[model samples]
Target: MKKTILLTLLVVSSFQNINSQEKREKDLLTSRKWYIKYMKFGENKREISDKTKNENWMLFNQNGKAEITTQGIKSIEDWNFGKKHEIINISEDGKFTEYKIEKLNESELVISRKYLNKTTTLGLKK
Candidate 1:
């Protein structure tokens, strides 16, 4: 009986840890501003220069909304993550865009978007 209790406690603790980690990721993403740092368009990969680094940013909110600043212009829109947290959908000006999340962490996010026959990779940093 003691062994069974110990095993159950271990399993419960493991699940709690996983839940906490997922919550942490979501919290981090919504609390900070993310800037575009790199992008790959077609076969060309380019790094953002200091001169243009402040041109684009994304601010996600816990209320299922996001504000995007591009070229000093701001737009508010609705955004959501997939149930598995591997996809991001953004709707703006009646246009919906979906991006596959490649990586996400405290300071960086990478996403891949496909439109038409082109696939573009975007790297963002906080």
Candidate 2:
């Protein structure tokens, strides 16, 4: 009976460790910001509008304040993992454009916007 209890405890401990590790990895990956690589309209390729590549950074304070930044735009985003795990926000530069979180996976995010005459996408760096 003692041996069985020990085995069960060991198995439970192992599962706990795995669960914690998985959660940590998920949190780390989810906190990262993803940018757009290319934008296309039907069959045409749009010019890359983001001039400063290194300026892009996704900020997550873990307190519900998340922002994604690039050259001339800084967006305050809302992330909801239960329903949609992506950065959704608007430009802070007064461009009056709406932004959407296009794709967010383990290591990347794709952000996009539609303005008066153009649609832009930015590829995020990890």
Candidate 3:
């Protein structure tokens, strides 16, 4: 009986820890609006000197909705994360695309997507 109780407690605590971590990640992601500050395109990871701030930005809501504006075009979308928070999925117009998260922190985020053997990475600042 003691072993069974201990095992159950451990299992419950593990689940709670996983849930808390996911929640923390989500909260960090939704805490602020992110502006595209850099791009890993032709050059190495460098700041985009030509674009103005807020010209290309994204905002995530805690309710699973997202707002993305690029070059003055705004889109309403839905977003979610993978089981381990290694990937994020954004859905627009009933279609969803998965992006691999290269880095995420309180003030910066980096994500990459692949298409036809080509990969593009975007760095965002809070």
lDDT of each: 0.84, 0.57, 0.85
lDDT per residue as tens, model 1, 12-65: 999898778667767977978899888898788988865776788889899988
Q: What is the C-alpha RMSD of each candidate to the true structure, in Å?
A: 3.1, 7.6, 2.1
- Model 1 ranges with Cα > 4 A deviation: 1-22
Cα deviation of 117, candidate 2, in Å: 3.1
Give me the runs in candidate 3 sitting further than 4 Å from their true place: 41-46
Residue 20 in candidate 3, Cα distance off native in Å: 0.7
Query: Best TM-score goes to which candidate?
Result: 3
Query: For residues 12-114, could you state the per-residue lDDT of candidate 2 as single tens digits?
Result: 9998987675455447645655443455653466544456554556665455456766554777865433222343444355433345667556666666667
Ranking by TM-score: 3, 1, 2
Q: Which 10-residue window in model 1 sums to the lowest lDDT?
A: 79-88
TM-score of 2: 0.43
Output the TM-score of candidate 3: 0.86
Best-to-worst ranking by lDDT:
3, 1, 2
Candidate achieving higher TM-score, 2 or 3: 3
Please name the candidate that would achieve the greatest lDDT relative to the true structure. 3
Model 1 score (lDDT): 0.84
